[model samples]
Target chain A: MENLRLLFDAPILTVQLLLDGILIGAIFALAAYGMMLVWGVLNIINVAQGELVMLGGYVAFFLFKAGINPLFGVPVAAALLFVVGWLLYRVVIFRIVDKDLFISILATFGLSILIQQLAKVAFSPDVRTPQAGFGTISMFGGAVTVTWIKIISFAAALTTGGVLVWFLRGTRMGQAIRATAQNARAARVMGIDTDRVYAWTFGVNAAICGASGALVAMTYLVDPYIGLPYTIRSFMIVIVAGLGNISAVLATAIGLGAAENISAFLFGAEYQIAFVYGLLVVILISRRIVLARQRRYLA
Target chain B: MSTATGKMALALASAALLFLYGPTGATAQTEGDTINLGAAVSLTGKYSVNGKNTKDGYDLAIKRLNEMGGVKVGGKSYKLKIVYYDDESTPARGAQLAERLINQDGVKFLLGAYSSGLTKAIAPITEKYKVPHVEGNGAARELFTEGYKYLFGVLSTSDYYLRDAVNMAAEVAKENGRDPKSMKIAMAFENDPFSLDVRAGILEAAKKHGMKVLVDDKLPPEINDMAATLTKVKAVKPDLLLVSGHEKGATLLVRQTSEMKIDVPIVATTHCDSAKIAETMGKQAEGILCASQWDRTLAYKDKWFGSADDYAKTFQKEFNYPAPYQAAESTASVLVFADAFQRAGSLDPAKVRDAIAKTDVMTFYGPIKFDETGKNTKKPMVLYQVQGGDYKVVFPSKWAETKIKYPRKLPTN
Candidate 1:
């Protein structure tokens, strides 16, 4: 009977769950967008994506420790990450840029381990939250509550996504990168420096990860081992949405978040990751079947 | 070619040097002047925080022992030295390190690693070698059921870790004019041995009291954001929200509770001050309660370490951080071994094991008496409530220092 009463209160609960899911999903979308940029242009799936996010979170934590607001630390981390990304490209990534997919995966996976170890040494394996000092606001007559930091992070993610979209559509470097991603041979024949584009594209993805990490530090907390989940989540999001489709990516991110939140509530939290990986397997097989059907008429 | 030759030569020289100095000198111990204690601790990785605390605890104990003229055994005094290895919180690595400590380091006395999983791995190695292992932290009762004669824990077993939390919840429920059977409690525990034991205990206790489990969930293995769990917790609106998410889960619960204002009457968790919740969360963690193995404010004391308060003050002076329960229990483990060593009056492992089997001494971390299963049977559980950035006892009528703000009101600031 009490459970039935909860069913009557479903509207308000749904609103709160959806709001929480969508906001957190925005952060996931930002991370997925970075994955899309690197995968579309460079044809490399960066397994170290989460490590970069973890690193950026450390940057935000340091800034927060220095008495800077975590909200303002976003761009600072992004800028720092851009430098790190560029350095990574010059040092290790550029060599593997034209390598086999498996080799690239191995290298980046190793890189993730190295970065995680370094962070463990530097930060000492503690879950630290960058204090937002922002309180909560009640919505729908106290049926729902939202933290101001989540709102700030959500807006930051949306604005960062919007700015990236605008930059891709409006800038020359972005056009060259898009051209390279669309047809590398043709772009190279057109005298475009595709190497430079690849470097900049990788750097931009890292910057995106750094910004997302800063936001995550405020909304959630940061840990050295917390990187792999972000990487796996971004990979799943990119696959579900299809690479380079910004709008689709955003929608899929929210969908994934909603699925996770709802599953956590319904099946309890233990099975939440199982549902996520299970969803990923289902999406891949179903998408393969759909593509197989699409090719049957031609065959 | 020359560079390769140079590198090979360097490697060969390093290997020879290692062989000469080797990791362990176990066989040399009888001839040597010092008693060696081998420790496989998680000095790095996720469990490092507690592991470090355990290390500091051992360090303080050893230093204090030396100050008191060390341990007298068989007509001679020998100072204690720990031959430590960093397990990085991996169970396989911890077991391997324990073996290495026995084989390479040749240490007879063993200190258990931090988490239950690591301790489980190390326990069998100690049993096989018949090395007397005195573990401080790993509280899961599962570690004892294997019936390793060589293994003993100074801290009480894990099922009892959260037993005090459950009893207090019922007490608080009754005080609030609510029936224990009518009250609902939600819980989320980490999927580790210690936490699983905690969950089992909480469930059994709740059943005894007839409290309905509103939400019982194991946190997802990898994801740190437990806001999803907290969201459900908000909707359920249970009388008490109990979590055994270890340190990370504890921090997340506190952060999310403050963020979402999930305002349950009581919020209890594992790793109260060990995770430094009061310092980290500040206002957010105020009034939160936890199942504590040892609180510094406890009046329990003995000859070596004085009172629990004295141990905390000394630990703070040395480590510059507040001593968590793990630290206190760790010091007690050392005291247990020393007491056994004194009674045996010998450096022989077998005799020392016999003495340890008959241990019935008191220390800063309660009494160190082990049952047949090698668990500390004398130490009692205490329920602690966070107040003004420190833990205050609120359970067990005798030790009730301050009243728990039942329903736990926040400061008006």
Candidate 2:
């Protein structure tokens, strides 16, 4: 009650919360975009989405250590992760691509653990941040503060989303991917090498995660186990946005981020995660209810 | 052919039996010239960093003790050796490993796991088995409240971690000519056994001083951001901001507080050294007060490690990193076991348990005197302020390296 009154009394805090939420949400949306693509095209949940992001952050971290600016590490990480995703698709993900959803979930979950453990061994379990040196921007006489790295992340997310839309609409490979997503068998019959398409789709998804992860490393600290939360957040955002809706995924991710921030402010940080999972439950139940009503109407 | 085959099979059967029972027999509390201690520490997973520290502390103590001709028991010298199993940082695994160490390996004496949660899980098993367990890492107050006679902790309870910070804030408030009762405290603690216990301690201290708790937020274990909580801090403008969430909590609190520039009069936290904030975050970590179990500069000396500074130096040379309090207290736990072994003059667990109960010793870590509840009553938690890229002790005037930097000036970068 006191916190709610404080929000009303000092509304600038609301702006700060929302701005932070939106900036963070943009990265969440970027991860979700990759998840949405893999879910739609490859029919795999890609539970290792967060691991890819974690690996991407490590890439930027190493680059920073090597005396390269982490800002340039964004594209480099994406490119490297693209190859990693392609190899992973060939080695393991390909076997589960055509399997049941449950099988894919279990397989990818195992992959997530494998990647996390390997990263732990390779990088050690230390919370690390690649210093972007972007500094902070104060607004309204320092009443609201925004980190420059976060703004860069926000801009990167937007640009990636725009580029993703253009790629899917303009390129011939994009049309082939769309066709495969619509009907793999039909696309295969039309001489569209659907196997390559699936591999590319998975690779592209990982690249997106890599880019988001670089931004995340610059914005917040990254650790080996930090990937699971990003996976959960991306999964939630994809569910709320639905499959194949790029704009909706972006908007819902931002909205979820804002709602999480506001709810944390009102309910205390202890309930922040509880609130997220609770909202997931509510969204799922309401959707089921609406579907049930439609079935009744049909009957 | 039947006679020769039967003879060979009989010999092989006897050999297999010997192979199985030989190792179990050797794993007894005392083997020949070595005293074996069993420990289940985190070698992997979330607590691995601290787990490694605990293991190193134990190893360093064992190495030093062995070099000094080991512990003299019953008119003979016995070297110390530890049988270790990786707990994987899970409470269930820790409990299971404790049972395995006791039942299967026949390890009579046990050392502790890393965190309080794992310790809490293993404590019941040790109590059930009548094994003497001495630990340095697990510091939750609830562990002491459980009435486990066999579980002796060398470190102060978790609640004491941030309590001194709260008291210091109150003192600062009074010094500034403001009513201490009018002060508001905002706390963000990780929702874990250890951190919540720290929160409880801070709350008690705040209540005793008649301070209002404006924001008591429980951060999720997987939290990467606390912007929402910080936003509330901005609005409420609490007199003091207290955060306790282990390494991640300390790191995030320092980073976000600087990024958001949420300037409260006092900002205090735990795990600043473990998180390496002074070294990594540098200018941003300046003026932030951190609660610690032990600091290298303390005037504590012992026969084994000489002084606290000497122990830290040896540890850094061995481990390639500065020894956090986790490692210090862990080393102290090993020292406690060695002392008990020497005093009891026996290899029996019950005798060692009794000796450990009557422990009144001073070491490089601190004077460790456990009360009836297995809680160390002699040690006081210290507070450190990050000054010019180093942790300088600024509280508990006896060991003060420097005076407290008042009101924590925000870096003008």
RMSD of 2: 5.6
lDDT (tens digit, per residue) of candidate 1 on B1-413: 69999999999999999886675443454436788888989999889889999999999999999899999987888888999999999999999999988877778889888978899899999999889999988888888898899999988788887776777878877877878898888888988877888888888899899988988888865757777677677778788888888778888888878777788888888886667888877878888887778777777888987988999999999999988888988888888888998899876788899999999997988877899999987777877788888778986545567888778764322
TM-score of chain B of 2: 0.83
Q: Residue A262 deviation, candidate 1, in Å? A: 0.8
lDDT of 2 by residue, B243-342 (tens): 9988889989888889998998789998888788988887889899999888888888999999999999999999899997889999999999999999
Q: What is the lDDT of residue B152 in candidate 1?
A: 94
Chain A TM-score for each of the predictions = 0.95, 0.97
TM-score of 1: 0.84
Q: Name the runs in model 2 displaced over 4 angstroms.
A: A281-299, B1-134, B302-306, B311-327, B330-361
TM-score of chain A of 1: 0.95
Q: Which predicted model would earn the best DockQ?
A: 2
Best by the lDDT measure: 2
Instruction: Report the poorest 10 consecutive residues by lDDT, candidate 2 chain A.
Output: A125-134
